[model samples]
Target chain A: MPREITGFSNPLIKRVRSLRDKKHRRREGLFLAEGLRILAEAEEAGFLPEMLFYARESAEHPIVRRLVRATEAAGGDVIETIPDILHKLSGKENPQTVIGVYPERIVPLSALDRSSADIWIVAQSLRDPGNLGTILRTGDAVGAGGLILIDDCVDPFSVEAVRASMGALFTQTIATARWDEFVSWLRAGPGQLIGTSLNTDQDYQMPTYQRPCFLLVGNESQGLPTTYEKDCDILVKIPMLGKADSLNAAVATAVMAYELLNQRRAR
Target chain B: MPREITGFSNPLIKRVRSLRDKKHRRREGLFLAEGLRILAEAEEAGFLPEMLFYARESAEHPIVRRLVRATEAAGGDVIETIPDILHKLSGKENPQTVIGVYPERIVPLSALDRSSADIWIVAQSLRDPGNLGTILRTGDAVGAGGLILIDDCVDPFSVEAVRASMGALFTQTIATARWDEFVSWLRAGPGQLIGTSLNTDQDYQMPTYQRPCFLLVGNESQGLPTTYEKDCDILVKIPMLGKADSLNAAVATAVMAYELLNQRRAR
Candidate 1:
């Protein structure tokens, strides 16, 4: 049986709400994910919420019932709360019926097997949580092994990013490291570092991407620094036939990712 | 010389600030755009703002001087204001040094020249302004003729959409029409309607996209209704090789748009 919490000032509710903040999430080693579908995706990805909260009306839902069973089986706490508490936890006008608090799953850079997939995505100094999430989704779509974040990228565990990811965060391997650390890791492995640059004359589609190809994208505004570009094995540019000088960071990543996937498939 | 205004309560100041709201923008037939770079892009695209606002600090900027000259020459209002006014107008902590209120540009579906470009983007019931803006940027990057919005969608002239467009709003032609009206217009022209759908077995890259291809993407949430999907000339699905079932609406559009572009280029 799930615990019933009617009080607005419940301690558990307050604790769950604090997961919205990055500091609190990092300190607790847990992050919040909402919506029945997302929570279901997490379960499908072999994850069980440490704590699950659902509105009273959703207790009869088949997926909710299954989630409650699985969470209980995993010795996790399940709580039934009111719509007000759901709204408070999600910080949205229309909150999801269910919310989950899951452990942060950041894979170490050294642990990633480059041979697990033919393609990988690397983002340096990516600032937008939404873009990060979108990239994760695109990475998953293209069957990339994982996403490697270099330098100060936005927290992948943020509510905005988690929501924007549409559950791709649970699907893709995520690793964070300094630029030097990432460079050393790449040098130790058999992978081609393909950087998207404006300075390059080579078109994006011109190259035959090698197996274990690492597609490197730059920051939202500044793009990749010259030093980082110099480290790349291949530099390519997407043609901008219109007056706009560049595509959105996430959009550029998707275009490049699909190109890599197409090239490998054609081969 | 530009008119100088310091009072926060000045009528013109209040009026420009009100342009941030959709209701005011629609009523006045003007929309707000900010940043020197975006305004420069706008100028390069042959648009003169009806009213241009610049901080006194930016008076010496070469681009700002050129803009002032062009605005004055075109009989547009040019105002020299403080940072506070710019901040208020842009609704950003560190606002752009310049802001412009330009006339809204929404071309009718009948007015679009189908022969102008080999590819066009069509979106149905897209709700997010950021996604809408990103799609505009993608359309511009691929040299697509324009973006055709179907049914009720977010206001293209909203400040959020304009900012997210990153000045692509000035380069790409924007049109809005209801589903029936759009179908009529499309039938009257030479174009292929390719839709991204999960219901199809056809791969997105398998088909040779016909010239003047119209890549249609649906809503962020519900996707295209069954009726809309049935209306498409070619329905294809992007392979989701991972756990995530779909891509972000804008990401899907970009993926599909580039595929169309690539197919055309190969021919």
Candidate 2:
């Protein structure tokens, strides 16, 4: 039988709610992954949660039941809770069937196997967690090797980002480092560093994306700064046929990523 | 000299704030287009605002000044207001320099010129204004003919959607109709109807998008219903390489739209 959590004051409940904040998430080295789908993806990625919680209504769900059983089999505790408790934890009016507290797994820059993966995405100072999450989903869709965060990008494990990722968070390897450090790492790596700029007349589709290529995109409003733009091996521009100045950062990244994949796949 | 309005209680101020709601937007037959970039795009597309408001700080901006001058020359009121009023109008802490009240222009299905354009997009009951907005932007990016919103969908003129569109709202021709009505129109049209479905094993890339193509996509959760799926000329699937079951609605639309464009462009 799984343990039942009745009160919001429960130490475990406090911990789960605290995971909403970046400070607590980083300090605890754990993040909340909500919904049965996300938890299932995590499990499939061999990333079972440290703790699992499910509502009574959700506990009756077959996937939730299986998740509970699997969690138990994996030496993890499953906590049955009221819907209100879950609603509070998730900050959603209608919370998901299940939520998991998973350990943070950060892949270091040095450990990245650059030679094995064809394309890598490097984002600089990305502000929106939703954009970051969508980028992760796009990256996974295009079979990109991994993602690297330069400078102060949004937290990938945030609820908004994780939800946006649609379980791509579990599949894609994510690394974070300072701008200078990433520049050094890129210099040492075996890949052409490609960047996007509106000033460049060269069309994005014109390029032949060589293997182990690093496609770097800039922040949303300001775009690629001069500091980062100077380090890129090639700069390409997406043609703007309409009056809209630029595509959304995530959308631009997806367009470029898929184009690169399409080129490689066709060859 | 542009009239300066100081009070938040001003009738114009109330009118501007009320534009945030769809009810007001529809009743007034007008919508809010904030930011200099969006306003510029609106002007460039020959969709001048009926009224324009600019903050003192933003008034000094060269583009804002140009917009103000152009609005005045076009026999439109160019009102100078405090930053707080502009912020309230935009619902942003740091509002853009200018906000414009533009008359709503809804293109009817009958008015659509399908013969002149090769690609079109049809979205069925899309709920997320953000996703719909992004799709509109993407559709514009790929040089699609226009967008058709089927059945009950979020208001494309809503601030959330308009902002996400990044001025593409001014460029793309948006049409709305009941699903049944859309089907009748589709049967009468010249385009091939294409859809994405998980049940379909055919890769999306395999198809040569026929001219005057109607690329149909389902809603966020409940994709195209069986009824609608049966109507599609081609049902294709974007491969999920990882655990993510589906891509974001806007991202999916973009990928498909761009792929179709790429195919045509290559030929």
Candidate 3:
């Protein structure tokens, strides 16, 4: 039988709630994922949460039981709590019945195998957690190897980002590196650095993406600096048919990624 | 000099702040848009805010000056206010320099010119304001005719949707209709309804999109219903290379929209 915690002041509950903060998440090297679907996805990806908390009301759910069994089998804690505690832990008005605290998986740049996949997503100075998460989903859909964050970007372990990822956080490998280091790594690898830029007259579709394509997107407001664009093997531009000047960063990345995927399929 | 309003209790201030609520906005048939950039985009698209409020500090900004002059020329009210009033109206910790109250523009289904563009975006039961706004931006980028909201969707006039649109709301035409009405409208026109679905074996890129294509996406949680998919001229699926089951709605829409755009460009 799993332990039941009725008190809001439980130490484990407090620690799990603290994971919502970046500083605490970083120090503990753990993050929170909510909802049964997301937790199931994480489990499917071979990740067993260190701590799994489910509402007592949901204790009888088949999926919840499976999760509880798997978690306990892995020497993880399984706790049954009331809705109030679940809500407090989730920080949501209508919180999910289940929430999990999982270890953060950050792959080093050196561990990334360039030849493992045909495409990789790279973002520089990305500020929005939602955009970052959406990009992860896109990367997974397009069969990209992973995401590489260049420079100061939002923490992928942040709750907002993890939630937005919709379980792609587990599906896609995430690595962080500075611009200089990323450039050096790319130079040493067999890859094509393709960037989306407004300065280029080259249409995005006009370029045939080479294998091991690295699709680089810039910051939301400034876009790629001129120097950064100059470093790209080829800079392509998505056409703007209407008065709006640009597509959202994540949207643009998906469009470009699909284009690359389609080109490969056509060949 | 523009009218100076110092008091937060001012009737105009209260009215403007109330526009944030859907009930109040619907009753007034007015919506609020913030930031100089978004407001300028509105102005360039031939929309002049009925009431323009700017912090006294931004009066010297050239774009703000242009906007002030344009509002005055259009016989719209121009008020100079403090940051506190701006903050209250926008509900942001740090608000934009200006806020605009404009009459809501809803293009009826009958008014859309299908032949005006090669592609059109259609969504059924979309609930997220951010997704709605991002779809509008995608539609504009691809040079689609407009966005047609089917069934009961979130109000496009909401501040969250408008902000997420990043000014594309002014560039793209938005229409709302029930599913029956939308089906009737498309059937009467020279349009091919292409839907994204997991039920179809046809890859999204396999089909050559016909001109005046109506790309239909379904609700975020429940994709296009089986009956809805059956109604589509053709159903297509984006290939998922990774373990994730699906892509974000906005991301999927963008990927599909760009594919249609690219097919046209290729032709």
Candidate 4:
């Protein structure tokens, strides 16, 4: 049986509210969800929620109740709170119906198909939660082999990341692994590695997707570190036509991903 | 001649902070800025500032003092404030030591080069500020004719939007007009009007970009409303290979714009 906690002072509610802080999220190994869609996505993806709370109005909705029951059945803790409590936890308006706290799911590189990939994405050190989420969603949309997140990236499971992903947080299998180990394994492969840089003479289209390839994009402000650029088998760039020397990290990633997919499809 | 206002209750200060509220932004026909780069872009793009505030730290810097003097001499209200007061008005971390309130800039369609365009982007009611901003930036980079924001779109001039635009907010001449007026102009146009939709049989590649065209993308969640679909000369879609039926509004807009640009370049 699950116990109901009513007050804002309750430790669990306090924990959920504090999930906004990076320290709390790290300590609890849990993250926040603002509305029903994210909770529903987590549930559908078979992610086990640690806890889910419904605003009083949401408690009456059949979908909300059903999801709560499912969460409990799956060994998740469920709670109902006054709207104010929910608001306190969310610190945002119209949190829809339900909020959830879930354990982060980390995938292993063994989980990704290596041989079948015509293209793959390697994300290195992004800071924004929303940017990470959008990148995951884009990688999923383009049918890339899989995503590899290098260290110092935003915690992929953060609330802002999840909300920006719009349920893609559940659908994409992004895993965290040692950057050195992944690169070492990648060195052994017949696959080619492509990285973006300003000085590269290689246009992205040169010697591209006829074989499995990896596309590496770096952080927004400071780009691919010099250490990794030398390791790339192919360093190329999307030809720039405008004075703006940059594209948002996710936009650049998407453009390259789409081009790789299109080139492979044509072959 | 400039005056420094110290009171929190001052109407001007309150109005500036009210910019944090969306309704006030709409009612006042004004938006806020927090940094030097944005201020410079605004000036370069010919936006006249209504008021300016500078901090003591920034006032000592040559560029800051120059801007302060210029803004005052331009017949704009200038207030010199302590760093603490300037920070409050910007609502941003690491305040840029300067803030400006500027009226919205809108261009007339008569000013657009109708003959030079084979591609136009119609943003149909996108409500997210970042996504809308990215759309404008991408539209300009990919060489789309220009951006079209329909009813229900968020204030593209919002601080978050302007920042994400990466200075495209200044270079891109965006015209805000009635969607119906846009549609009637498209109907009389020398180009094909393409709207992005999920159910459309018209694949994005169906028409080559050998001719002038318009691509309309819908809002973040509920895509193009049905009435607007009727307005599209041709509705085309970026093929989604994944289960998620969509991409972020900005990403989708970029992909579509790039496709047009890519097609034209190929020809």
Candidate 5:
């Protein structure tokens, strides 16, 4: 039988709530994956939670019962809590039935399995969590192998990013690298480094993206710096027919990624 | 000389702040465009603001100075306020140096210039303001004719949507229609109605999109209803290689739009 808790002051509840903040999430090396979909994805990806929290009504749902059983089978704790606890954990009026605490799964760039993925995304100093998450989801949609976060990008495990990813966080490989570290890894390349910028006249669709390609994208406001663009094997730009100067970073990435996928599929 | 307002209680300031809410925006027939980039895009699109507000420090900047002069020249009010007033209007701790109030510009489907565009996007019951805005931006990037909003979509003039558009709101033609009304208009066709859904196994890129096509997309949660899909000339799905069941509505729209652009460009 699962433990039942009602108090807001419970130690476990406090710890789970603390996962909402990046500092605490990083320090503890754990993040929360909420809702039935994310929990299911985590389970399918072989990432059972350390703790599973659910409301009484949610636990009554057939899917929640199955998830609870799965968590128990994976040696995870299953706890039943009041709606108020679920609301606190999720910060939504109608919180989802399930929230799981899982360890942060990011690996260093060197540890990434380069053998399987033909394309990789390297995002530099990305500031928005939603864009980072959307890129992850888009990367997964096109079957990109992994994501490399270069420099100080937003936390991929952050709540907003996780939500925007729509559960791709559990399905995709994420790697973090410093500028020097990323550059050296690319130089040891199995593929080309393609960067997108506004300075170039070349249409993004013009390129025949080399396999195992690492597509490097820049920050939202300031695009790729000259130093960074200089390092790329080729630079491309998505044509802008309107007055708006640039596509939103995530949208631009998606256009390029899908174009690459389209090219490969055609061949 | 432009008027300087010192108090937060000013009626004009209150009215500008109220633009944040949909009710107030609709009631007054106005919305806001903030920051230098958006303001510049609006100016370039010939959608000048009715009133311009700026901080004292912002007024000292070259672009702000030019914008203030341009607003005054264009028969619009140019007001200077304290940073707090700008903050309240923007709902950001660090507000942009400038904010502008502009009238809502949506037109009915009957008024859209159908002959000018070879492609358009019809978003059915889109709920997210940000996604709608991104779609607008993406549509503009691909040189699509316009956007059609079906029943109960979020207000395109909402602050979040307008901001997400990054000024594409001014450049793109937006029309609203009911489901029945849209069907009748499609029957009086200038284009083919292409619907995208996961229910179909036909890959999205496989089709040679018909020109002047209307790409119909469903709501975020409940995708295109069978009834809606039944009316489309062709139904297609973006392939999913990973665990995510569906792409974000905006991302899916971008992928389809760009694929069409790529096909056209190749020809």
Candidate 6:
């Protein structure tokens, strides 16, 4: 039988709470996810939780009960905690009442694109954890093949990102690839390459991305760096009609990805 | 002369710290904004600060100095304190070394459009504060004329929303308008109404968007509402070639908004 952590001071509980900080996440190589919807998605994706902390209140919830069964069947511990204990352990006043501990995931490039996409998003130097999470969730929803982070991206497995992603991170494939590797892969792919830029001459719709393609988005503030300036095969723009000249990195990337998705379906 | 608070135990400091809570925000009808950039934006937008809290260590920053001057000029109180005190007073560790207490913005609908875009974004049932903030920032950066909250959307002026906006909230006109009033306005505008829906039968390009108009986005989990189903004159989709069925709310809205922006520029 697995151990039941009745208090927040329990070593395992302490370790789980420590994940809210970057250091603990790195040391343990673990992240945290909550909410029944997210847990359900994880279960559907064939993820096995190491521990399932469920609340008495949520025990009646179908998904929560299902998750407990799934974890038990997977040979994991299912610890039932009172609502107050669950809240203390979660550090959230309104805890979801269902928490899971799963291993950290770092998607491989090969596994990311089991099949190609009409448009794939490459995030370079995007540092905000919230933006990264939002982008990953959007990429998953838009059905992008995967996401590529060139350099200096905040870890996608961070707690803030997991909360922002609401579990879409598991559904999306993310790879950390260098620039040289990206270039070679670009040359190998059948899709056209498009990158967002401020002064780009090409309109977003100028090209018909009929096949698999790459849509690269840059940092939160300064866009594509000068080094990658030459790396772009074609520069496209989402025209600006006001003084504010840029969109949020994730939002811009999703829009570009949507354009490609739009074209593919139209054909 | 406005009173200057000098102690950590001051009631003003407690009230300022309470701004971090949603209930406090609702009760006080005020919110806190961090950093010098947001303060400047708020100041420029004529949203006067009632209390300016500056860390004694960073009162010399040019932007911080400017905020001080603006607050003084506007008859607001400027409170200078040690970094620790500022952190305590501001309800955030490190607290940008500076923060300003500003009034909640109530954007009048008539002030939204002028020489700018006829393209607007009406988010119906957007639930995430971060997503709303990202969309607000993205909308400003992409030169969106305005943003209209249709129904069941989080309060856009929430602290999380303002922080995610990245200073874009003060740059554009944002208002909470009823769904019926806003949709009628979009329909009356010079553009076609495009809405993303799981029930859509066409791509965004299918109808050719004969008029300048609004693109309606539904909540992240729930796509555009069934009630607004009939309001969308053009029902379009961003095709999903992968596993996910939808994009994050902000990303999807940005993508849709920019498509309209791109289309306008092409014309």
Worst 10 residues of 4 chain B by lDDT: B40-49
Docking quality (DockQ) for each candidate: 0.87, 0.64, 0.85, 0.51, 0.76, 0.52
Predictions in order: lDDT: 0.92, 0.87, 0.91, 0.76, 0.87, 0.74
| Higher-lDDT candidate of 1 and 3 | 1
lDDT of 1 by residue, A1-267 (tens): 899997989999999999999999999999999998899998998999999999999899999999999999999999999999999999999999999999999988988999999999999999999999999989989999999999899999999999998888898999999989999998997999999999889999898889899999999999999999999999999888888778999999999999888888788
Candidate 2 at residue A153, lDDT?
93
CA-RMSD of model 2: 2.2
**Model 5 lDDT on a 0 to 1 scale:** 0.87
Per residue, candidate 2 scores C-alpha lDDT tens digits across A42-161 of 878778887899988767788888888888888887899998999888998888879888888778899888886788999999998989999998888878888999888989989999
Complex DockQ, candidate 6: 0.52
lDDT of 6 by residue, A42-81 (tens): 8887786788887776678888878888898889878887
Clashing pairs in 2: none
- The digit string of per-residue lDDT tens for model 5 on A1-267 reads 788988999998998898999999999999988888878877887788889999987777977898889888878899999989989988878787888888999999778767687778999999989899899999888899889998889999998888888788988899999988888977875878999987788888777888878889899989888899989889999886766778888988988888778778889
| Every candidate's CA RMSD | 1.4, 2.2, 1.3, 3.1, 1.3, 4.1
Order of all candidates by lDDT, from best down to worst? Answer: 1, 3, 5, 2, 4, 6
lDDT of 3 at A160: 79
Q: Is the docking of candidate 5 incorrect, acceptable, medium or high quality?
A: medium
Q: Over the stretch B1-267, how does candidate 6's per-residue lDDT look in tens digits? A: 334466878888888888878788878888888777677777666666788888777767898788888789978888887677677755565567677777776575565653356667778878888888888787776667677787778877677888888677776677777887775655554655678887876766555664447767888787877878777777887665444566677777776677666666668
Residue ranges of candidate 3 with Cα displaced over 4 Å:
none
Over the stretch B1-267, how does candidate 3's per-residue lDDT look in tens digits? 589998999999999999999999999999999998899999998999999999999999999999999999999999999999999999988899999999988888999999999999999999889899999988888898889998878898899899889888888888989888889988997999999999878988889889999999999989988888988999999998888878999999998898898788888
lDDT of 1 at A41: 93
lDDT of 3 by residue, A1-267 (tens): 688898988898898999989999999999999988889999998998999999989988999999999999999999999999989988988999899999999888999999999999999999889999999988988899999998888898887788888898998999998888889999996899999988889998887889999999999888988888888999999998878788889999988998898889889
Clashing pairs in 6: A141-B246, A191-A212, B190-B212, B191-B211, B191-B212, B192-B211
Candidate 1: list runs displaced more than 4 Å.
none
Please give the lDDT score at residue A177 for candidate 6: 82
Interface RMSD (Å) of candidate 4: 1.6
Model 4: which docking level applies?
medium
The parts of candidate 5 lying over 4 Å away from their true place are none
